[model samples]
Each structure stands twice: as structure tokens, then as C-alpha cells.
Target chain A: MRLIHAATGEGFNPPSAKDFELPPFIEGVDWATKPILLAFLSVIFISVFFIAASRKAAVVPSKLQFAGEGVYNFVREGLGREIIGHDFLKFVPYLFTLFTFILVNNFFGIIPFLQFPTMSRVSFPYVLAAITFFIFHYVGIKKQGIVKYLREIMFMPGVPKPVYILLTPIEIATYFLVRPLTLSLRLFANMFAGHLLLLVFFLGGEHLLNGVLGLKLVSPFAFVIGIGLTFFEFMVQVLQAYIFTLLTALYIAGALADEH
Target chain B: MNKDENALWSIFGYLLSGLLVWGGIGYFVDRWLGYDRVFTLVGLLLGMGSALYLVWLRFGRHSG
Candidate 1:
């Protein structure tokens, strides 16, 4: 929607998909963008925090140690143990890293001066999902031999022979294509939409201010809603991270399960 | 929160892929055969039906 003030002759350009097409920080370096920079920063930040938290290990734990261990134990017990079952220990490191990395980068969306969620850039989620896809499939292949794994995935027992024609392709697609695609798309779509929602309110509020006196009064309402939604977005960010990690664990669990 | 809730997502994935893969084939067939939306609709119906059946086989049969 275009908001044009007749008297001022200034038009409000509503935020669109164009807003997501961020420009490079460097003049000519196409890959040097805000999302890439923030992703690197998130990795560094997580590493530093965890390293520092564990550096001073004590029986009577320090606050930082408690916090670090809190996050670690939560992922290890809550996610890795409960979801992944008996052989959960080996996957803890991967699950822990995935949770913390996603949580940190997602929180960047609401952080001042670093307002973009890295996953909003679809490529980041694509890479994460690809890693998850390979890891789970590899785990399955290792657990079950290639022929057995393929058989289990392709043919669900108890199904009639004639039905295999209809169901086999769906089964293959669900495992290989659908799983990773949905995983990445879910994260990417949520972050993309959340950022866009915030942009609509905040940008609309800003544009409203440059209007007549009546519109100026309405701007505060927009800002208020924007602030409220920021809190909502924070909850969503955490949930999305949790869900992504949880699903990864679930996929691993499914792969490791002996029976289909 | 529970494993069942997570299975719900798998059901969704199954249904989505079913529609996409089958309907996609239909669309391509239509393009190849120079037909309008005839196969596309048939493919979508076939997809939805098969997807529901698949879901029943995976999840529903366990209960009943």
C-alpha cells in the first residue's frame, strides 16, 4: 500500500521483499553482506562464551560455569537423552552445537544494530538442513547396511504389493527430499516472515510520522504494537531453534531405531 | 513436546511431498501432451488420496 500525502507530495513506500535484498558491506564484494558477517560473529560469540564459562571449572561452580553447564545439560538431557534414547551420548556434541548456534543467530534479529536473523537468508538454513540431512542419512547407513536401509525406507512392511507403486515414491521423497526441504523452509519462512512483520510495523510507524498531525498521533500505536511483537518474536526465535534441534535429534533417533 | 506431536510434522511433510511430486508430474504431463488442467487435477486428487493412505499406513494403523 502506498501512502501519499497530497500536500507534502512525499509518498510512503511500504516495505516489500525488496527490503530483504540486503546490499554488500564492501563496495564490490558481493558475498560480503550483513547476514554473513552476523553469522561469523555468532560463531565467535558462542565459542568465546563457552570457552570462558568452562575455563574456570570448580566443584562449587561459578555463575558462568553454572550458566554454561545449564545450557549444555539441557541439550544433553532434555533433547539428546529424552529424544535420542540409549546411544545419545555421541550425538550430544552435535545437538549442543546446533542449539547454541541457532539460538545465538536467531537472537541477533532482536538485538540492536544487528537486526537481521541469519536464517532469514535462505542459504544459511539450506546449509544447516543439508548438514542435518547428510548426518542423519549417514547415521542410518552406518546403523543399518545400505541394502537394509534402502529396503526399510522404500518398503513399509504389511503394505500390499499393488500399493507399493503408489507409496514407494512418496516414501523416498518424504525421507530424502521432503524432510530436509521442510526443515530448512520452516526455519527460513519463520525468520523471513517475523522480520518482515517487524519491518512493516516499524517502517510503517516511521513513515506515518512524516505525515499530518493526525497521522503523527497514530504512529505511537504502531510503535507500541511493534514493541509488543518484538517480544513475541523473541519467543518464536527460541522456539524455532529448539524445534530445529529437536527435529534433528528426532531424525537421528528414527535412523537409529532398529524397526521402521 | 511429545513424539506424537513430532509425528504430526512428518504427516505434514508426507502430504506436502505427495501433492508436489504427483501434481508436478501431472503438470509436466499436461505440458508435454498439450492438455489444459485435466491431468493436473487428477494428479492432485491422486496425490492427496495416496498421501492420506500413506499417513494411515505409517501412523493410523498402529492405533486401530
Candidate 2:
């Protein structure tokens, strides 16, 4: 009976070996290698673009100047001045660099061959968050002494005494714990999820087109969804970059604000 | 305003407006993507982490 059971069809139906294969994109790279490579490439690309664009500057503005200035003003006037106030000129370069870098890298995610979103890597977002974090807080403390800064973040002047106790802990936790995490994760998750969805639809479409008989009928629907998602992904790519920069500015404001 | 006060206000205004703008973008992206809870959860974590890190560096670190 034992020998018969061992030889039975039920046990013979082993899982398909194909299930163990690595996806095409990730087949060669060592641990998180693709993201790192993409990030380095993005930096180089951005650096070269900026250096070339900024090589010549004119009062009347050349095509390069126009393009550069357009982005500069978009962030500086549209985002920076509107949020940080007119005195935001000091931080415009940093904001400009941040916005352009993220935008270009996010764009790189969708391009073939380099199909990874660099910001989807936790480390990249974390580094950006850390930089913004330091800038705002440092400016805050420098402007308002340590004691005042603490009071500004922790204590609201108008709240009742009992409420103050409750509010203080909540405020402290929200300000100190919650902010940076959300900032990094917001960019990370959007890019991560967006990339994943694109991958699923795209690969699903490809598989359907190439897979079993009669299953090919489903390929058109999958292909349509894939095409639609590509457009949607493009919008998200721009939106996420804008949000990352906007949030960085917001945190800076919160740190420097006298009240909540 | 004094130079310091001007600087502080400048940063504050930028940060506040920036947050609202980005926060709105995040909300819309989540809505459009249809992830609902997942998007909100991730956004919350990212936003909180960013805020906390900024605060720590500002107050915790001695060197500017």
C-alpha cells in the first residue's frame, strides 16, 4: 500500500519548475542593484543636463535659459514663493535641484531598458526626507532659540491646561515621529505601487498575447488597460515629484512657524 | 521684521504652503489610483517620518 501511494498520480503532480524562475528584469542584478544603478545614472543625467543648460546665461534669455528659467520660476514663484514667502530665494536652488532630480528620475522609471523608479528605493526617499528634515529644523532652531522652538512645536498658547497635556504628547509625536515617515513613504509608495501596477498590466498583457490557445482573446483587453495605465502612470510620475518637493517646503514652514 | 524673523517667516510660509499643495496632490493620487487605504497609510507614514526627521535634526543635532 505504501509503495502504491508513493507512485500514485496525486503525488506525481509536482509544482511547475517555471514558477521558480526569476523575472527578466531582475535576473542578473545582485541584491537591490538595479535601483542603485538607475539612481547613479539619474544623477549623472541630471548633472549633465543642468551643466549644459547653465553653461550660457543671458538677460534676454536663450532657449536653454528659457527652459531652465521656466523650471526655476515654476518652483520658485509657483511653489517656493507661494509657500515659503518671497524671501525664499535663498532656498530656490535646493528646491529646484530637488524638483528637477525627482521629476527626471520618475520619468526614467517608465523608459524601456531602465525600467526601475529610483525613488521607489526606500534609501533615496529617506535621504531626501533627511535633507529636508535637517534644513527646516536647523533653520527653525537657528531663528528661534532652542526653548522657543520646543515651545512652538509642543505648546499651543490658547489651549486649556488639561488639553495642553494631551495635545503636547500628540503634537510632539505628530511633529517628531509622523512627519518624516509620511514624507518618505508618500514618494516611495506612489512610485513603488505605480511601477508595480504598470508591470502587472504590461506583463499580463504580454503573457496573454503569447500564452495558451483561446486565452489570446483576452490580450486586447489587457493591452488596452496597459496603454491606459501608461498615461495614468505618466501623470503620477509628475505628481509625485511635485508632492515630494511641496512636502519638503511644508515641513520647513512648520518648523519655522511661530504657531501651529 | 528683523533678518532672523524674516528668514523664519520665509521658511515657515514656504513649508506651510508646500505641505498643503503636496498633501492635496497625494490625496488626489491616492483617489485616482484607487488604492484607498493603502495610499493613505503609506502617505501618512511618509509624511510623519519626514516631519519627525526634520524636527530631530533641528533640535537634536548641535551642528547646523
Candidate 3:
């Protein structure tokens, strides 16, 4: 870490992972964190948005209704029909819910006065990943008998019997460990890093404003760049949410799939 | 967006999980046996090989 003093006062304290550890809004309550509140707000926001969007649907839809239907059709045809095959309808609700929930919650990062992304809290993504994990495995088990599912996972065709000893552990680890871990980590990491990036540029700009007159002049560039990155962050947030839901749908499709 | 992208992500997940799981198991085995670096290396190589094979089986065989 380089220590560069601004000649005006103390060195700037760069944002660290510690900034993520936001203090509880309510005293003496372990569960009263900003992420929890944001998560609840997100749920309410999603519920209200969708209900209002659909409540007054007519022959010629309004802009809000069109927007809602656009999102639905995207997931329905793009993800569900393509991935889940003939049984796509059964999972559209789940996929839609997952997509909207994540997309809304992720947008919290950019929304004014609610700059925190709830998924960056780590456990949120973990729970979401855990849900997909359980749902897919259960679907697979129910679709194929337990023994057959396990057998299919553990042994792939065209591989020699001796190689089974090598491949089985990898397959099991990928299915039972890798899939969910990556799913959660990908979302968590993107949000965490995006938040940190914003924090860096914005905070750095503030720090620069307090510096020597020469340094203060360059602060606007930092601010401008920070503004630019926010739009990039928006793109990343949408992409991450899409990827997470897409992977969930893919897993379900894989579970329902007959063979390799 | 397409089937290849799905396969690509799956491949990455499989490769990472293989390394983490087997390499972790190998680390534990090393600690138990007091070997210097043999088990860990073997575990990693085994994991990488098997993961690539699994990727080939799932993506390669299916597409072609």
C-alpha cells in the first residue's frame, strides 16, 4: 500500500472490505442491518411493481404493462422454452420470480439513498444458491429414481471402467459443490467488487477535494469517471442477475434432461 | 446467450470445483500422512484431468 500525503492533512483512507460491514441501524439487534432492510424493501418493491403492472391489463396494454410483459416474455421464451424443453411452463413461475427478485434487489445498489447491494452481503447469495441447489437435486431425484440419478451422475458413458475411479469424484464435486458455490460467488463477487469500485472513485474524489489546491482541481475527473462507472455497474448488475437465473434454469433443465 | 456459453460456464464451474474439492482432500491427506507435497500435487493433477475429461464428455461429445 502506497502512502501519499496530500500536503493538506492526513493521508486518505482508501475504502477497504471493512466498508461493507455497515453498522446496524437499530441498537442491540443482530438482524437489523441495512442489507436486511434493503432486501425487504426489494421484495415490497417487486410485489407492488408486478401487481400494479398487471392489475389494469386490457386489450391495448399500457407502457408499464408492456414493460412487465417484455421481461416475462424474455424469460419465458429465451430461458424457459429454450432450456427446460417441453416442461418449460411448469418452471416459468419459478424462473420469473427468481429473475425479477434478483434484478430488483440488484438495482438497489444504484437507487438513491439505497446504495447497498444486498447480495454483496454473501449469505443472501448463499441462500439463493442453496435454494436452486435443493430444488434442482430434488427435481432430479423425483424425475429419475434416486439410484439411477446417482448412477448417471457418478458414471458417464464412453469412459473406461477404470477411469470411473478418477471421474466420479470430480463429477460429484462439480454437481454437489462447484455449481452452487460458483453460482453464489459469481453474484456476490460482482456486487462486492462493483460496490467497492464505486466506493473507490467516489471516496477518492472526496479525498482529493480536501487535498492541496493543485490536487483538488483533478478531483472532478475522478467524479466524472465515477459517474461513468455507475452506468457500467448497472450493466453488470443486470448481467449478474440474468446469469444467476439462467444458471438456475439450466440446472433444472439438466435435472430434467434424460442423458448427457 | 447460446449453448456454447452455457457449456463454457459449466466447464469453468466443473474445473474450479474439481480443483477445490480434490485439492482440499489431498491437503487433508497430506496433513494426515505428513508428506511434503506429493499428495497435493497428485490431487490437483487428478482433479484437472478428470474435470477436462468431464467437460469433454458433457460438452464435446454432446455437441458433435
Candidate 4:
């Protein structure tokens, strides 16, 4: 009697970084071409959509107006209010832009042809992180004056002299080194991992269905898992976008606050 | 030394905690997804690699 090989059958090649490649646009620009195009296209699309939506102001509001207002209010109230406090409204535009830009790019990752998440490329998220870093630091220095802000950041009120010697170096390292690193990595890693997982499940399912025999029964299971993972990826796409913006606000709040 | 420095330090603390919490979550998610120990191990390596690169940038490259 012949036994069915479940795990031994030809399985789908697990998705790797190489699987996600961008087509070349011209001669010298190969990898960078697609991302640049996507970024430019995203900016144009978002700008056009918002500008068109708000072009006409109505008392009752049209479908476009509703969309604009809903997105604006959601980012302003849900994320900004919760994280940035009273001054949240001031940064609404930046926050809205960040959210919409990231959300669109992330959704692009799952789209059939445009399968690259711009943020997954380190440079994209690094730029945002640098912007946040500069904004918060500038606000801290400008609001408190450079001297006062320095004092607030490095010297706490209650620590002992001996503790200061030990803690000061650690504190200094944390401020100058870790902040931007985490900021960039959080968004980058999330998009990278989420995309990788979706690739694995979908590609794995395809491979199992087509490449293997007798183990065809497992194809149904792989399909179910693939479907389930896609739904989860959708949730993650939104959540990561929210978390990225939320953390930016939180960092800004830290810069703006006086104590604690 | 000064209030601005203290604020910076405080913000850094907040950032560190945030990173630790989120990174820990990602690590656990990899474990839960049945990727075996390899996922967590890869994350650890990535974290260390990032940390080393950051140190090199901040201290090694910038000092000159």
C-alpha cells in the first residue's frame, strides 16, 4: 500500500526578499524607479482627491465632502487628540498626510501588480522619522529655550549624585541614539513582515495546489489559511498606519510636555 | 545638567519603552505564527545588528 506524503510533497518556496522586486524604468535606475513612481503617484492622487473633495463647501455635504471630513476628523480626533492633547489640531494636516500616505502605500503592497510598500524601503520611513525627530526637538528647544530644554531632558530632580554618574550616560545615549532608530524600524519592520507573511501563505498555497500530488487535500487548508491571513493583513495594514502616526504624536507630546 | 537635557532624557525613556514593548510584541507574534525559534532568533539578530550600526553611526562615524 502506498502512503500519502503530506509534508514531504513539493511545497511552495517560502517567499524571500528577492521575490519582491521592482521593474526598471530606464537605464541607471532599476530598484529605485518603481518606488519613486509610486511615491509621486500617491502624492498626486491624495492631493487631487482632497483638493477636489473640499473644492466645494456645502451646508449638507456631498459624498466627497463626507469622505474628506470623516478622514480628517478620524485622524484629528482618534489619533491626534488621544496622543498629542490640546495642540493636536495644529498638527492635523501633517498627521493626516502621514496617515493617508502610509495607508495608501501599505495597501499598494497587497495590490496585484503594485506589490511594493514604499515604507518597506528603509529610506521612506527614515525620512518621516527624521521629520518627526526634528519637529519635536525644535519645538522642545523653541518652547523652553535651549538651556531650559537641555536641563529638562538630561537632569531629573530627585536622583542621587552617584546615580547621576551612572544614569546620565545611559540617558544621553537613549535620547541621541535610540529614538529615531525605533521610530523608523517600527514602521519598516511591520510592513516588511506583513508583506512577507502574505506572500508565504498565498504563494505556499499556490505551490501546494499545483506542485504536489496526493497532498492535494491540504490545498483546501492552505487556501483557508491564505484567506484568513489576507484578512489579518488588512487589519494589520490599518493598525500599523495608526500606530505609526500615534507614536509620532506621542513623541511630539514628550517634546512639548514639561514633566513626566 | 539642564531642563532641556532632562526633557530629552525623559522623551528617550518613553521612546525606549515604546520600542521594547512593540519589538517584544513582534517577537512573540513570530513565535505564535509557528515559525519556530528561528523567527525570534532572526529578530534578535536584526535588533542587535541595528543597534551596532546605530552605535557605529553615532560614535564611530560622527566623531571625526
Candidate 5:
């Protein structure tokens, strides 16, 4: 039992959250890290792709044109139109930019040589949520007027007077704090956990290769699961991006509605 | 399309805020009055109940 414990404990250097703490590329510059560089690359890549795809302006779109149009239509028709109703067109540009930007950044996790999802860093998602937070509140203020909006949020029309004390604080807390917190946390947690999972399988497989006979024999299974999970992670990454954008649209719709 | 997705997040937000706001209130009340964990438990259950009721009002009635 002791020998087995030692082998398992010493041999297995399981990946933890610490592994995500990548140091800056330059010695003194704190801003330059792997994820930061990957984010910049994602922006450049997305910009160039869309610009090239649209430059020709053909009546009948070629393969590249079709691909760009497909993505645009998906967001406009599926999310913006369904969620925002008549105001959908006004918000499509924001939704399109958000969807494509998040999708590409998430895809970076599985890409060769650049295996890092920028959204996993937490700050990226926080910033995105912050922008959505502002947009929705601004829309609400603009549409309902600030006084009516605040009154609607704090006081439900049907509730009793005594119960207002109980319900109003909860409502305030939910809108101001919990909404943005969960919005950012959901995306960050998914990417962070997915990346950590992949690292464990790959790293464990490599470690097993250097172990005794029994471990060596089992290493291939670890690698096989690792390979399978890469594909699974791709699906999850896409879904997370879609969910994030979908929620943003819904929030905007909620803000625009006359009632709370 | 809109209500279903929004409902999920809204439910989550309601539950979280319920716990934080009510639970914090209970905690401070207990510290002030020196109760032996009574108010904290009461506060949590109250929070959860109200949160679920809020969810029912917001989403269940609408059915979308």
C-alpha cells in the first residue's frame, strides 16, 4: 500500500489552477502574456477575415462570402430577431460583433500552438459583462425614463405594501450584483474548467509513459480520452459563446419592455 | 426564444441574491443579538423560499 501510494502520489503531478498563471513574455512587462497575445491575434484574425470576405461585394457570394453571411444571418435571425423584436436590426451589429469575437477567442483553446481561451482569464469576461451591464441599463433608462425604471425595478405592482420591504432589497441585489456576476462567471468557469480538464489528461498521459510497466500499458487510454475530449471541448466552447450572446439579447429585450 | 433563456439566468440571479442579502442580514442580526445559529438558518430558509416564489411568479406563470 505504501509503495503504491508513493508511486501514485509522486508520479501524478495533476494539473491545478496554478498552471493557468502564465508569466509575462517579456521580463519587465506585466501585460504581455500568452492569453493576452492570443487575444490580440484573435482580433487581427477576425478583422482580416471579415474585411477580405466583404471586399469583393459580389451579387452571388462565393464560398468565403457564404461563410461570413451564414454567421451573420444566424445571429440576426436566431438571436436578434427573436429576442429584440422590432428593434432587432438596431442591435444586430453589436450582437454580430459580440458573437464572432467571443467565438473566435474561445476557438483559440483548441487551436494548434495557441491553445489558450482568452475568456478563461476572467478579466475578459468581466469586461464583456460590464459593457452589457451598461448597455442594458442605458436602454432601460432611455426607454422607460430613469424614475419609472427605478420604480418598476424596486416595486412590483401586485405585491403588498408590507412585503415590499422584503422583496425590494432582493430585487435590487439581483439586478445590480447577481446578474453581472453570473453572466461573467458562467463563461469564465466553463472555459477555465474545460482547459484544466484537457491539461490533466494530456499531462497525465505523458507522465504515465515514464512510469512502470502497468502505467505504460495504460497511457494510451489516457491519450485516447484526451483526444476525444478535445472535440467535446470544441462543442462546449461554441455553446458558451452562443449562450453569452443570447443572454445579452434577452437582457436588452427585458430592458426595453414596458413592464419590469 | 427570449423568455426561456432569460428565465434560466434570472432564476439563478434571484436565488443568489436572496441568499446573499438575507443571509448577510441574518448573520449580522445574530452577531448583534448573540443567538446560537438560529437566525442564520431561518434567514437562509426564508431567502430560498422567497427566491423560489419570485422565480415562479416571473417564469412559471408566463410559461415561456
Candidate 6:
């Protein structure tokens, strides 16, 4: 509130959702934006790092291999095996890819010069959630025949006959609509809000520099808070990535359950 | 711990979907009938009650 109070005539313009609309990298091509480029770059980085790490297999592991395995084992044991259980091996590859891909793209938020989280764009998260939606449904159908799966989702056992009319609709909506909708929205909101927070402090600090001497002295505090928030944003970025993958694994595990 | 977390999320999901779907239906029904907002409140209360019952069935029943 005091931010706008400091400037008398020309009030400080704080950052908003409009700031997220980044311009295209190529003027003529509409789709060629910074986030898209950064997404592709992340894919390449992950692919190369993993391939190089595994290329030279040795009993005594090197640094790259150790780092690669560390990430792999984390997903495999912590997420896949612990969450999915039993036939968790089959799902590890998907979980691993989801985890690393999200982690790298989210890290782009604080990575200098390329400070844009691709997932901050709603479309990216939507697509990722869609993939997860299809995969989990497919797994369920494959495991328990389509008829049984639908029956399980549509009708909960031990419920009174009349109650089905009320509970069934909620169950269907939760599974089909809310599940993926919440999944994607959670990631998109986190990245979008985190990016906006940093932009506010930094841009506000820059704007303050042009004001009177009293405001100018206060600018450094804004910059300092921005720096501190960047570190907090790092923790958020990592946690969001983990949660996204964890939820995906949980959904898959739920699908694979015989008695829903 | 993992199972507890899973249950919590499912409970949250069920509660949210319950309110949204039923309250949404009630809103449209009210609009169609040209009533004020009577059905919407009824639907919301019904949804919250049913969602709690569903949660008890899924999670609470197993505890005791």
C-alpha cells in the first residue's frame, strides 16, 4: 500500500497477469515464445545429462552417474515403489520422466536470463495433466476391464440404493473432471504466482529507484526481499514438481487398486 | 504416512466435487424454475452432508 503512496503524480504501476504475456522470440511466428523455447531446451538438457550419465557404466560410479542415479533412485524408490507398490516398476519410467521434466522446467523460473517457468503458461500444465489423465485411465481399464472400472467409479458398494443418485454424480465428477483439473491448476497457479511475486519486488524496486532520495534508499530493501524470495521460490519450485509427480503416481496407484 | 496423505487428498477432492457438482445443478434448476436462490443453498447443504458421509464410508469406517 505504501508503495503507491510514495509516488505522488505518476503512481507506481505494480505487476499483474499482463506481465506474464511474454512477447514472441520470432516476430512473425506467434507460437515461438520464451517459455516454449525454454521447454524444448529443458528436454534437451535432461536427455543429454541422463544419456551421458549412463553411457559409461562402471561398478565404481563417477560423479555424473551418481547424480543421474540419485535422481533416478529418488523417483524409483520414493515416488514409484513407495507410492505405487507391487507392480510399481512398470510405472517408474513415466514417473521418472514426469519428475525430471517438471523439476527442470520449474527451475527455469530462477535460472538467470531464462527466468521463465514454462508451466506458468496454463497450456503447458494442461497438456501434462491430460497425458497423466489418459495414462491413469488407460492403466485402470487395462488392469480391470472397462466395464468393472466404470462400475466401480459410478457406484460405491455398501451404500443405500437411493443414495446412489446423489453420491454417484459426485464420484464421476471427481474422477473425470476435478482430478485432472485440480492437478494442472495446482502446478499452473504455483508457478504463475511465484513468478508474479518475484516480478513485483524486482520491478517495484526498479521503479522506486527513479523516485525521491527517501524512496531510493528503500529500493535496496525491496531488492533484498526479492533476492530472499527467489530462494523461497526455489523450494516451492522443487516441491511443486515433486507433488505433481507424486499425485500422478497416486492417481495411477488408485486406478490399479482392485477395490476402488 | 503415504496412505494417510492419499486419503486426505481424496477426501478433499470428494468434498470439492460434491459442492461444485450439486450446487451447480441447483443453480441451474433455480434459474430454470425462476426462483430466487432457494435451491442453491439446499443443494450446498445436501452436498456437504453427503460428502461427509462419503468420507466416513471411505476413510473413517476403517479406523475403528
Q: Candidate 1 lDDT, tens digit per residue, B1-64? A: 6578668888998899889888888999999999998999999899899999999888889882
- Residue-wise lDDT of candidate 5 within B1-64, one digit each (tens)? 4666677778888999998889888998999999977898889888888887777777676654
Q: Rounded to one decimal, what is candidate 4's iRMSD? A: 10.3
TM-scores of the models, in the order given: 0.95, 0.70, 0.94, 0.74, 0.94, 0.95
Which residue ranges in model 2 land beyond 4 Å of their true spot? A1-32, B1-64
Compared with the true structure, what per-residue lDDT tens digits does model 1 show for residues A51-128? 999998999999999999999999999998898989999999999999999999999999999999999989999999
Question: DockQ winner among the candidates?
Answer: 6
Q: State the lDDT of candidate 5 residue by residue for A98-162, as single tens digits.
A: 99989999999999888999999999999999999999999999999999999988877766688
Location of the lowest summed lDDT over 10 successive residues in candidate 3 chain A: A1-10
Q: What does the interface RMSD come to for each candidate?
A: 0.9, 11.2, 1.6, 10.3, 1.0, 0.6
Candidate 1 Cα errors over 4 Å, as ranges: A1-9
TM-score attained by chain A of model 2: 0.84
| Better by lDDT, candidate 4 or 1 | 1
Across A141-242, the per-residue lDDT of candidate 4 in tens digits comes to 887899988787666565556644434444455665567777788889888888887777777677777754866768778879877877787788888888
Chain A TM-score of model 4 comes to 0.88
DockQ of each: 0.80, 0.04, 0.69, 0.07, 0.80, 0.88
The local lDDT score (0 to 100) that residue A35 gets in candidate 3 is 93
C-alpha lDDT of residue B39 in model 2: 60
- True lDDT of residue A178, candidate 5: 88
How far off is residue A208 in model 5, in Å?
0.6
Question: Which structure is stronger by DockQ: 4 or 6?
Answer: 6
Ranking by lDDT: 6, 1, 3, 5, 4, 2
Every model: Cα RMSD to truth: 2.4, 12.7, 2.4, 11.3, 3.0, 2.3
Query: Candidate 2, residues B1-64: lDDT per residue as tens digits?
Result: 2234433533443344334433555677788987665665565555545444444434345543
